[model samples]
Every structure is written in structure tokens, then in C-alpha cells.
Target: MPSTSTSLSPLSTGLARATAGLNLCHENASEVWHQRPPLDFLQIHPEHLIQEEGGTYRDQLDDLRHAYPIVLHGFGLSLGSCAPLDQDYLQLVKRVLKEHPEAFFSDHVSWSSLSHHHFHDLLPLVMNDETLDYLVERIDQAQELIGQPILLENISSYMRFRDSTYDEPSFINALTERTGAYVLMDVNNLWANAVNFGENPLTQLMEYRQSSVRGYHLAGCTRQQAGDGDVYIDYHGEAVHETVWDLYEKALRHFGPWPTLLEWENHVPPLERTLQEVSRITRYLNDLSVAPGAT
Candidate 1:
């Protein structure tokens, strides 16, 4: 049985909390546990641990809980949806956090559900004042229910809404200003969007200083044919791109080396191979630590 406490402690509240981490995948979990890769913390989608309805804990979750500090990243909240927040989903999230009270949880700034239908991919939001107000209300309710502030991640968007009033950083800044939610800055997604949309990643990163960014996601994407042009899809199925790594180092210089996790979801690889990606993060952190003017 898990604890019933509602207290949520800040895991990476301070600057430079940890350098490298891995997203615990279901397929490689047993091997990861047996091999015990060197990670500062382990992240999991809490949706994987508890059943949607019964809220029962899986044995694997219990095992992992005893091994390392957990960070919960979720995709089902649909925080930007016009459809009301799913009470059952909120309950499921609350249940997991109650047990792993030290864990900090996060979800996307986009929607996955519309009315009763659920989409497999995270869809983009309009990014206007109307959407911002709706998200603020829902995020407030969720924080009240979950007993802590939530981190919201920016998703990779294929297209932008014409009526959007704010740029990505400005939109996220407004949300953090209004609701006090932290950010799980996905550097790869930023790079993907930059490539797909003709934007500058480093410039946007400097503008992202307004939010409380506590974590980072580094992953690879696929370049797919979009008619006559090439669009980068955030597949998270390959190695971290060189462009993303360059931006990540700039981000570390800007954001002070927050807990960075390597997310390899699609074609999951061996634990050692996965750790190699994490090792890159380690090398960057090591260099940054000794760099001039670094604290």
C-alpha cells in the first residue's frame, strides 16, 4: 500500500538540481532496475502505475518507488481542452501523488480530449487570451485537487493557429504568471518547432526566462515529408540531434542545468544504449560546471 499524504515537495526547485535522468519505459524497466543506470532521478507517467478506475498500484511502481525519487509526467490531462477536466483522470493523478508525495507532476499545454473522444497525439492550442483563461482556471482547479503546482511542457506543433495572440514563450509566460505553474522545457521540441516553423531556438529560449522552468526533455525527432517541404516530427524514437544538443548547451547556460531527461519512446533501445544518450547530458553538465562565470 502507498501513503495517503497530499504533501508535494519540490524535487528540482533550485538551480542546477541534477544533470541527467531517464524516462522509465515499460519495456526496459526490468533491465533498468537490474542494471541500475546512473541517473539523478527517474521519471514515469503516473498513468502507467495505477488503473484508471480502481486506482490500484502495480507492483512495479512499488518497486521503483523504493529505488529512486520519481517525477510524474502525464499526457492525459488535456489541460487545454474545452471539454471539462476529467474527474476520473484527476483522481488517478491524485492517487499516485498521494503515495509518492515527494514527486512533482507535469502535463502538456495542449489538449488530447475533445468532448468524449480522446486523441492519441497531443494537439496544439489556439494560444489566445480565451485559451489562456480557460487553461488558468483548469490548472488552478488541478493544483487545488492535487495539492501542488504542476509543470506544463510545450508540445511540438505542426501548424500554428492564425488567431494566436502570443508566441510560445509569451503564452507559457502568461500561464506561469497567472497560475504559478512551472515549466518542463523540452529542448528537442523547441528545436523541432524551430526547424519546422523557421524560428530561432536560442532567441526563443532567452525569451522563456519568465516561467519557472524546473526540468528539461532531450529527445530525437524524424524529418518527414510535408508535401513539398520537410517537417520535423517529435518522434522521440531516435538519438538526440546535434542541433538539439547545441541548443541544450545554450539552454543550460541560460537555465542553469535543470534536471534533464532523455526521452526515447518509439523504438526503445537497450539500457546501455539509452544511457549513452544520458552520458551526453553528463558531459555537457561537467563542462558547464567548470566553464567561466558558472556557479
Candidate 2:
């Protein structure tokens, strides 16, 4: 049977103790396949592996599963859309999960579609009671269809709608409270928003519900010129910025150690460099685990 727990599944619970992992990407597949790194678990995008020639480890699901526990992180659910859930997309995800019922699933809280047209980008939602109600209904239906809870991730926002009634943290907490879903807190995205819009990461951490946050994502951003100032884009191309690491450490202190994944998709680096970043996450988690007053 598929996992139905609102909290972390058995595999995710075990991986939380393991501390760190990497987002499975085709660019690093050869090295990962030839010499399996010491990853706690692997996060895969179902869309990237739905076909035999999808280039995500070149259709080696069986071989990869033998080495590590898997988790599904999707990008096409478009949960924030006003339209009904995409049955075809859901079917592809269902097929993958049917084979690995032990895996947990996650997707962004932002919308990416308008009717039949897909934006191919994680667009921000207006944080209001109406939007929240809409998302709650959509998430409920999605959970029912998938037969498991999902971790709704915070996407990096370049701008905010003036009609927003609730801040990001409040909206996310309310979503989780209403739907019994978990939060895939992406610290890099938080930091990007902070850099772009003066949002305080420390304040957000305090405002967020710790119990709702079940996992984390760490990635790098690109700073580009915008108007007179600069904008920080969640590019995931370079190394983790120093400011992001600071925020990540603060998150660990706030939420305790959880399963964290390092995402390096753009300008994919060498496998060694990728593992090095994962090592940094492991180090942070280990430090937190051994800290004073730790559980």
C-alpha cells in the first residue's frame, strides 16, 4: 500500500537521520551510477523519468533504487491553478509511485499553468483567503488521487501582488494546517526573496510552523542587474552563497535537522563538487544533532 501519513514516511524518516542528499539529475548520472555517493536519499522529478529515454539516469530506476531511497519532486502539478487537476500528468506520477510506494512526494506551491497552456515557470500566487481556499481544495484532491500527503515547497518570488493579504509564511502555515500536508522549506528561495525584496529570513523562520516543515532544499542564486539595483534569481547554477549557508544554519536551529537536498541543475557541476555541497549540508546537520539541548 502507498504511504498515507501526513508526516514523513518511513523512508523519509530514515533519510532524515542520514541528513543530506542530492537532486538526481541526468548530467551527473554516469558518475552517480558508476560510483554511488553517500547520499541519504535521492529526489527525482517524475516528469524527468516518465519515459525510457527521459535522460534521468537513462532509465535506470531499478539500479538506482537498489542504492538509495527515492523521493518524487514534481514541477507540473500546477496546484495553484484554477483549473481541475491534470489527469494525464497525475497518471504518470501515479505509475512511478506505484512502483515505489515507500517514496514521499513534493511540488511547488506556486501555479504553472493557465487552462491548457503551461507557463513552464513557477509563478507566484496572490496570498489571500480566496487563493488559500482554492489551493486547499486542489491539494485535497491531489492527495486523494495520489493516496499520500505532499510537501508543498516555497518558490522564489521576484515580485509580490499588492492584493496579498497574508505573508508567505502565514499562507504556507495555513495551507499545511488546513490540508495536513508538509512544507519542503527551500532556504535558498527564502534568501533570494530576502535579497530581492528585503524579506527577513530570521523573521520568516520564527513565523513558520516547525512541525509543518518536513524537509529542506539548498541551492545557489544568480544576481543580475534590474533597474538601478540587482535581483537575485533562483538559478541553481553556482555554489551555495555564504548568506544562504547562514540562513540554512539558522533554519537547522529553528526546525531541527531534517532531510535536506542540494539542487544543482543549471550549469551542472562536477559530481565531486556536487557531493562537496551535500557534505556541507551533512556537516551542518551533524553539528545541530550534537548541539547542546539537542534531542
Candidate 3:
């Protein structure tokens, strides 16, 4: 049987205390239907769930929708691109949202396309005033078209732009302030960047300096030793690391809990193994949700 606990939103007090359950990728929908683990929600990638020939959604996902609440995580919104917003793609996304009006939508802060050509990766961005202004304008445009506010997630980057002005966290804080946007914090990504950039992960987050977390993302990345030193890759594969868990503990301690996600991007694990991971996370969340003050 599924746990009685429900997913917590940033607006909810419980979110501050943790207590949110597991949210898995749509690829695990079938497994979830069979196993019926205590899940909070299922995340659907827009890139994967395209419309059918009849202009309707893939009917197969209907079962998953009926089983659990869906949250839309976009890969191709390209809000960071210099090119104009892709109206056709946005319409498709809006249509899907209409089908599931209750679903929350989000995408990475990084650009995945340029000059109408997609790189298919969450490419890094410069955190200068120009980039900030560009992204804020596009976020406003995206929110207007989507008919709801959207969350922008921090993307893991291996390189930094020379033209960058403010730090990533500062830019995000300003971005949200300028556009009334929310954030989906990826702790692992921050940790990876910290490891690679020689900065403290907690300091990276604390610089945001506001409770701007609308959602949270957790995934594991492998570390490789290079000629220069060590570098961490945000591959979203493998099990969660203790260091990342420690960062998460600090995040929960400071910001409390928001709607958190466990991304099983590649090197997929079996359904049973995924279940064990979720159970472990749930126990941690349950322990943490009982914060300093509340019951």
C-alpha cells in the first residue's frame, strides 16, 4: 500500500519541515502501477510525451495520470535562448497542461537551444545583467503563455562564462525578484558545482538568501579525477552520495522541505531498487520533518 503522506508544496508549512514523499520519473509509471509504492507524484517530461497524429496526447499515459498527479518538467522550453519563444512548442505544452490543469510545470535555467537549433543539453549561461534581463523577460512571456507561474531549476555547469557578473545564486535571486518567478533547487547540481568550482555548496545556496525554493531535485553524479584535479558530473545516475545527502540535510535544516524530486536520468535501476531508495529518502524526510518547533 502507498503511504498516506502527500507531497508538500513550498506554500505549505510542512514543506519547511520536510515530510514529502517520493516523486519518480514517468518511465517508472508502469512499475509504480504494479508495485504501488507510497509515491507523492510522477514527473512527466514534455520531450517524451508529445502529441499523437490525432492531435491528442499519447493515450498510454492516461493510466498514469489517473493513478497519480503529474508534474511537467520541460527539456525544450528554451527560455534562455536569444531566439524568440517557440510558440508551437509552447502551445503543445499548454494543450497538455489543459488536459491536466493541476500539474505544475518547470524547466532548467540553462539554455538548450540557440538560433533555433537545439543542443539538447542544458547549456550554461552567463550570470551578467544582460543574461538576467533576457531570462526574466522570457520567463514572464512563458508564464503568460502557460497561464500559470513556472519554476526555473538551476542547471549543473562544468564551465563558467568570463563575462559573468554576479554568482549563480545571486542571479537566480534577482531573476525571481524581477519576474515573480520561483525556483526548483537541484542540491546535487550545486554540490557538483561546488566540488568542481572550489566553493561550499551550502554557501552557494545561502547566497540566494531567501526562501525562494518552490521545488527540490536530488540525483547522483559520479566523480572523476583529472589532470588538474577532480570533477563531478551531474549524470543523474547511480545512488545518492553521502555528501549530497549531507547537503540535503543542511538544505532541509535551513529552508525546510519543498516539493523534492529524485531524478533517475540514466543507468536506470530496477523498480525494487528504486523503491528501496525512496524508502530511504522517506525515512530521512520523516526524521527531518520533525523540525525544531513544529510537531
Report, for every candidate in turn, its global Cα lDDT versus the true structure: 0.80, 0.82, 0.73
Better of 1 and 2 by lDDT: 2
Residue 216 of model 2, lDDT score: 92
For model 3, give the RMSD to the true fold.
6.8
Of candidates 3 and 2, the better by lDDT: 2
Best by TM-score: 2
TM-score of each: 0.89, 0.91, 0.86
Clashes by residue pair, model 2: none
In model 2, the runs with Cα more than 4 Å from the true position are: 1-14, 51-56
Which regions in candidate 1 have their CA more than 4 angstroms from the true location? Answer: 1-16, 51-58
Clashing pairs in 1: none
Provide the global lDDT of candidate 2 against the true structure.
Answer: 0.82
What are the runs in model 3 whose C-alpha is more than 4 Å off? Answer: 1-29, 51-60
What is the TM-score ranking, best to worst?
Answer: 2, 1, 3
